[model samples]
Target: MYDLHCHLLPAIDDGPADLETSLEMARMAVADGITTVACTPHIYPGVYENTAYGIRAAIRAFQCELDQRGIALRLVEGADVHLAPDLIEGIQAGRIPTIAGSRYLLLEPPHHVAPPRFEETVFDLMVAGLVPVITHPERLSWIETHFDLFERLAMRGAWMQITAGALTGRFGKRVKYWSERFVGDGMCMIIATDAHHPRRRPPCLMEAREAAGALVGGEEATNQVVIRPRGIVNDVPPSDLPAAALRTCPRDQRNANGPIRASVFGRLLGRKTGV
Candidate 1:
């Protein structure tokens, strides 16, 4: 299987801190049944600032080490770019590398929320004749709150990627709920590991695929979801969302206790209010 988003490159971003850790992570990925992975180090302007030349050089160096170590996994070059006003321009000027040299850019929206210019940036990328493959939409609060945004993004040629851990509920129930919704809505195009380390964020694509099967059923359905992501690196469109029933999840998880008053705050407020 092809993992579209991964931070296996050492000393680049918040992934493995050194080469030893990266090699271990790579070994873990191979063991987990992932044959290919796109090394998506951060090219976000403010946070990482990695250029295509720098990324290519890093990937080449890493590949040499892999060959020497006899690791069979193939590494591809790409960037996890945060939406910037100059992003579309940078792509046009050949500054940013597309995923595996495809027309797709593995876009990383802001952590707390989808960026305000998110839709416009996607539209711009489409107008620039490139496809915008958004990474981990399940983690975004905006997408969780408003499912229509996902449909809108998809309609605008933006594809959604859900993290493997999210599907396994490693991120928490809310994230899992949103992820399941996307899968059901035919909004999710790919499920990737996004693994950073060997222990905490290990390669578990197989586990994720198994969970998807339990929830969605069959290997073909799961592969249809996963293959499109790998195809991005080769400049292929992901297969259409399957017409099977998406797993159901609760829409509202609110409680009747008025935000379920926190213990410490409740004690302090109780003393103050004499209740």
Candidate 2:
């Protein structure tokens, strides 16, 4: 299997703290049947501040280390890029690296709110000949209420990636509920570990694949984790994707509760609460 999103590089952003831990994460990935992993460290300016050249260098170093240790897993260069006003400029300047040098880019939206003109930004990316793969929309609170936004994005040539843990209920019941809906609706085009460590949030894809298979069928699940990811890394257009089901999620399967409620008072008190 090819994992298109993971933060396994040492000392980069919030990934493994050191090389030893990174190697352990690789071992865990291999045990989970992953052969290729894209080292997608966060590329948030003024925060992670990871450039394309630096990510490439880090991937080369990690690849050499894996080779020295006889680990068969292959590391590829990429970034989980935070959306910014200068995103197109950064890509044009080669500051942002696409997935394995493909036209596919892993685009991360802000967790708390969808940026203004988000669809237009994605449209601009497509116009610039880059495919923006939106990461982890199921975890975003606003998307639960405005699901048509995601469907519109899909229609505008954007892709969605669901985290493996979210599908398997590792994040929580809320995230899993949405993840299932996305997969069932064919809005989620890929499933990746988004692994950050060896254990908690470990590199595990098979469990999620099995869970997805129960909804979409085994072959379709394989395509999500294997075929589509391989195509992204190899710069090929995704093929044999599961056809969108004509049936929407049953009413009973839909969340009865409304969107996650965030309190302005809680924010003023410096306390965070959600359900």
Candidate 3:
């Protein structure tokens, strides 16, 4: 399986503090069936302050360590980018790292509060050519009041990701409810381990996959971990993958934000290419 969002780099943020712990996380991920993991650290402005250059450098060094120790896991570049005013500029200037350098990126909204123009920012990003993969929206503190906003975003074009742990009830009842809703409603496209530590937030997705299989069919559950994630890392257009919004909810499969010039994601690509 492919874990498109993970905090595996050492001392880079709230993740592991040293290389040993990072290596141990890698082992845990490998054992859990995640062969490829995107080393996505936080890019909160004054907090993490992680840059594409620094993240890539850290990944290269960490990957080298893994190789020396015979760990088969592959690391790629990504960032849990907080909603910033300069987001478009950062991506345009190459300061922000997308998943595996693909056109898709993980956009993390503030957990505590719902900011202004949140939906507009997400739409603007899709128009600007980057597919905003909203990370772990099910766990957002204000999700209860923003369910309609989320549905609108999904209908428009944004991709939503639910954390793997949330599906297995690691975060408690409310969070698991939202996660299951996202899965059963076909609002979430990916299930990623936003893993921080080996125990506190370990890199595990199998339980979530099983839980998803129970909610959705086993095939759709497989798509979350294997098919859709594989397509994103390879830069495949979103239309090519199974439409998440169309699974159980037909309303979101169409353009909720007016007309589209082409396929939901093909418009971003300017062409139709297949995997």
Model 1 C-alpha lDDT per residue in residues 47-162, reported as the tens digit of each score: 78888888899999999999999999899988888777788878778789888888888888877865676677788888888878788888887765666666777755577778
Find the 10 residues in a row with the least total lDDT in model 2.
258-267
The residue ranges of model 1 lying beyond 4 angstroms of the native Cα positions read 224-226, 238-275
Whole-model Cα lDDT of every candidate shown, in order: 0.75, 0.84, 0.87
Q: Taking the tens digit of each residue's C-alpha lDDT, what string does model 2 give over 79-129? A: 999988899999989999999999999999888886899888999999999
Which 10 consecutive positions of candidate 1 have the poorest summed lDDT? 258-267
Angstrom error of the Cα, residue 54, model 2: value is 0.5
Error of 2 at 61 (Å): 0.7
> Compared to the true structure, candidate 2 yields what TM-score?
0.87
Which candidate leads in lDDT? 3
Please give each candidate's TM-score. 0.84, 0.87, 0.89
After TM-score superposition, the amount by which residue 77's alpha carbon in candidate 1 deviates from its true location, in angstroms, is: 0.6
| Model 1: per-residue Cα lDDT at residue 101 | 86
Ranking by lDDT: 3, 2, 1
Overall local distance difference test of candidate 2: 0.84
